[model samples]
Target chain A: MNHKNALTPWLFIGPAVLLLIMFSLLPILVSLLISFTDIDLIGLGNWDMIEFVAFENFIALFQDPLFHRSIFNTLVYVSIGVPLVIVCSLSVALMLNYMSNKLFSFFRVLFYVPSITNIVAIAVVWGFLYNMDVGLFNFILNSLGLQNVPWLEHPFMAKISLIILAVWKGIGINMLIYLAALQSIPRSFYEAADIDGANKLQKLRYITIPSLSYATFFVTVTTLIGWLQFFEEPFVMTGGGPLDGTMSMALFIYERGFQYNEFGYAAAASLILFIFIIVATLIQFTFNKSKEN
Target chain B: MKNRFEKLLITSALLIGGFIVSIPFIWMILSSFKSEREARTMPPTFWPQEFTFEHYINLFQNLNFGTYFTNTLIIVLFAMLGLLFNTMAGYGFAKFQFKGKEAVFIAVLATMMIPAQVSMIPVYLLLNQMGLTNTMSGIILPGLIAAFNIFLIRQFMTTIPNDLIESARIDGAKEFRIFFQIIIPLSKPVLAVQAILTFVGAWNSFLWPLIVANDQALYTLSVGLALLQGQHSSSFALQMAGATVMVIPVLILFIFVQRYIVEGFNTTGIK
Candidate 1:
């Protein structure tokens, strides 16, 4: 290699490496430092005004009922949202795989629509759908001679409503994932099952579900992590509630740092969320490993 | 007879499911065209009693939809710049020999686990210090180099045979020429994947734009729509129109490039 060529690789990778360091790597440490201090709007303006109060923000977070509520709400979202996403997406994938006509391809595109559309727009449409008096959902209920349900009013109902919308929006990409996995499973396995006189249910149980284990794991982990940081839907739809019923950890962090100007408090809250995510991901890894063995 | 029955069963199930899935989108578009009085009717009409474009006209005239659309386009355009930089890095990682290359690549992959929320506060502070806050650069800069894009491109480029580059170099091609003339053309499939994914992500991004652009003039479509929802909570037709305006472009884009977009997602899941 020539002298000029020795520097060629750095020329290629320099800009991306610099950016990754600036926005991602450095900020992780900076976030950790900020979490240890009391940095507010005034502190942001004047660096000297910031006070380093170690663990105080975390201590306060532990005692804060609102933070507690946010954590509980996040758990509720992940628990319900993750499973519902897996089941719905997997079922849709299995159905799509059963038929390979033009109509099925069209259905695949239709089902994938919500995944690509802007979330704020979807939230607007869904907000009207969840409207108490004249919403389509309530309209259907009343048409059947039933009372109107408060989709986003009652706290539990609000969580359920959010989960329903989430599942609706979330199933598409995962369904595609499962479909890809399904296509890759060798046809000969099914041919063998047929030779053994396996029925549809028996074939699905012994062959299809086992073949889909990795896709399911992938879908579950990604979906679980996504739900943990859930913010946009609740932020846009409920503004964290009729009564703080939908406050996710991410939204709580935003409300603290930006809305309340409690940057340090919010940083601490975010770090806790970060720890929760890392721990959750690690647990999932070990669990999946055990299942495989 | 049984085979035909099974086909009928699956088709009906998919048809019913597709309708249920599309109801909100259908309702949004339908309601956007409804007259204001009809939009608010109790037990809402399935079809508009009187279709009109008044809400869309109002959105353009009064709501600053033009500014929001322009801002969103600018962000997306700048974000596409990342594809070039990432592809360069991906090519370097895939084809070139360097010290600590594996370590650097693994580090890039590891950063994917760190949530954007973790760095968000400091990034805001960093931008404020740099005097970029509330500017288009503020929204554009943080997301300009995603690790995932670099990873995707590198994996794709690895499959291109190294002999193509070696032969071009033997014919007196310089390093940069080899990359631009030889490698880039071969990498089009992955580049298409990267471009479409980047365009969709940048266009639909909300939280970063919301955080960085406190100025209403700088608000992108997503933030603008959220603000519209807040400001006009009772204007059912107006909000629906705003949403339709935002979604129509994406839906159209999907229809045109649905294959590339779907394949891009499948690669992410299966790879």
Candidate 2:
């Protein structure tokens, strides 16, 4: 190894390392510290007025009904959204891999466009589509002689609308990941199966899915982490409306801190959510580890 | 006959899937040009019978959305500039020898798993203390140094050959100069990827901007577009026209950089 002077290395990384620490690392540590205090926007303006409150913020989070509802909403969403996005992506990937044509590859790129588009912007367009009197979805349903659905105004329907929107906006990227994985599988696997008189379904069962397990697990892990932190979509589209059925954990934390100016309580709630993601992620990883053996 | 039927099934399925995906965007564009009556009409018109530019005209004239648009562009450019600076740092971490570098790199990567929402309040406090709140800098400062970009760029730089660095070092080049001359020139792909991601994130950023940008003048296109949607009672169609205006930049951006953008998702997903 080329032994450069030690001081010189720090010189190269000094500015960037400093920026990351101040912006990312230090803020995270400070946030954890703030979770234990009773700080509000007033104290935010005057730092000395901030008072240490011990576990009161965490205790208060336990007492709040909205916190519980936020937890419940987050769970329901993660469970529903994670699996649906994975399955949709996997199915699309499978179809793309199975097809024999130039047009199939064309479809892949076209579908992936929305994956990169602004999630906030897409949520707005979809909010318009979910609009009761004027939305395209309700209009189409009404035109088909079906009962008009209150997509955003109703509670359960609002949550479902949020879920559907997430899956649609998110699936393209995950699909491409799986598509890359599926395409990399050797053709010999399928060819050998064909020689063994394996049908399409059997080949897929024995070879395709077995090979896709790694990609599936990776997609599931990241999707779970992302879904746990689901904020932008619900915030932009529904605003936790129609009896707060859709108030997510992240949104609650944001509203607690940003909107109502309850820094400690929001920070505590956020820490709790962060803990949940960590625990859930660990459980998923261990479960995946066992399945591998 | 049976094979033909199967082909028909697959064809129809693909068509339907593609149609569902494209329809929302197409509707957004169409509804923008429609009159309020046509927009809220009983069965919404699929195509505007009388296409009008009045809505587009209103978005520019009445709304003054150009300010938000320009604000987004400025913040986005600055964020991209920040991304370049961070990438150089990432390259240093990957290739350069520095005391505490490995520990520092791991520390930076570890922070990636920490949800950024938790830090929103503290960062707000930081900006408040610095007297930077409610400005574009409030939107841009915290965004400028991203852990994800650092991780991604370092991951890319680690793949570059060690000999290139050695050759440059033997030429008595300084670390920063070598990074700029050799590493960066060859790192165009990852840099392009970084540019697309940073630009998109900055352009579409809502939460941070929503919190920091307290004034109408400082609003990014995203927050402005949403607020505009909420403000207008006269014409929903006109509001859509405003959205079309907001989205046109991103769509045009994608049209040129489509491949890099796709490659971006793949790379980020890999991490």
Candidate 3:
């Protein structure tokens, strides 16, 4: 009876636990160990060919200009993209709060379409929009007698263009999150604010923003982590080009690992990317925790 | 008067936001109907002057979209089976109390924070070792049970009343029977939620599929669309048609299953 009791849970969870350990947990450990070694494609099967590099890969990455540039571009992406997405989504969510049920659901679905659509498809569509000559944006500029901007060709514009696409891709999910958060806030708080003669902006600043802090934290963390691992937009649309202008850390790691077959180097880069995610998330938690007190 | 004006302002803002959000999709669909010349013409055509199905024809006839769609179907099918396995594990966690249960659950939850990229290389190597590389199984294996999905199912299963299970056990019902007969039928909403999410995710997945299966025959719709874009880089209408084909199914699924999708995300996310 005791043995059966012990075995019952395992019977249910055994497959999932086995797979998770094999795939997720084991890979996590293997990757961490691999990050410490010098192992490439040829050394993949033959353990004898691998060497213990022990921080050499990390040191090398720190000195690599392209790696440095990738890190800088990722920071530029996160710092700008996270806040921009949050504000846009929040504003949309706030506006959405005013709509009737039928209208709100309609607009909600419209806003969410892009989030669910694959990023590659979105990139292709945006590529056409950002085309140098006959693109819609340039056509609009021409109509307004403004000079046609090289949206994806120029380095500065390319970064901005990539950020724009990221922001567009992200807004739908965050908007829905914020909208749900907003809907959960009790009406009594707003009633009290109104009775206290608080204006719209005052109510917003005090009640709405404070109510959204958790959602804001969630969004900021996710958006920051997402930007740190940014790959798809630049991969598809720009190919990390026209001058490595839109290259992100994720794309950089992918290029080194897959394209160059520098698996060891890519593993090291992936570890660094993991460290950035942890540090960023920890900072957000610390900030939120302190704010809570 | 103030209230009415406020309402008007809010409506206008939402309309503008909606318009901005829909423009690219609208343009993609519109351009799919335009001729190659019109699509690339100066001051690009917003509405195709004379609509045609040439691009759609080309997408099916030339691009082999049917194969890509079938590949995605196979991946999603296997992934759904994986979701069932996750639910069973979640049921175990939620109902059965064994040693180190809390510790085990937390460990699983913690895996959620470690991004998939961290594990990509080693997991790929593991797949290679299993001789699953370039097969749909390789693409499906690593994603069998994500921490988030396990957490989701666990959370849902915890709400199932204990007395029902106890009663079944008292009647000499085997644990598996109780799971398959009672718990699963009751957990329909969450199971449906997981199915929709898994379907959408597997359907949209690109990076893993791209890495695992390099063969043209095994390319999922997303990977296939990407490859199509590369080969027909200048064919705007053809690419748009491909995008339309890729997006339309998921969009249609969303329209029907959105309540489950929305509630699943909102509940899982906020909590």
Name the best candidate (by DockQ).
Answer: 1
Off by over 4 Å in 1: A1-4, B265-271
Across residues A234-291, which tens digit of lDDT does each residue of candidate 1 receive?
Answer: 9999999978999999999999988998888988999999999998899889988999
User: Which candidate gets the maximum lDDT versus the true structure?
Assistant: 1
Tens-digit lDDT string for candidate 3 (A169-229): 8999898889889988999999999899999999999999999999999899888888888
Q: Each prediction's TM-score against the native?
A: 0.98, 0.94, 0.96
Clashing pairs in 1: none
In model 3, which regions exceed 4 Å deviation?
A1-4, B265-271
Tens-digit lDDT string for candidate 1 (B127-156): 888999898888989999988888888888
Q: Residues B175-221, candidate 2, lDDT per residue (tens digit)?
A: 77987798888878888878876787788877778889899989888
Evaluation by lDDT, superior candidate among 2 and 3? 3
Which residue pairs show collisions in model 3? Answer: none
Q: What's the lDDT for all of these models?
A: 0.89, 0.81, 0.86
The window of 10 residues in a row where model 1 chain B has the poorest summed lDDT is: B262-271
* Model 1: how far residue B1 lies from native, Å: 2.3
RMSD of each: 1.3, 2.3, 1.8
| Candidate 1: docking tier | medium
lDDT score of residue A208 within candidate 2: 88
Docking class of 2: medium
Clashes of each: 0, 0, 0
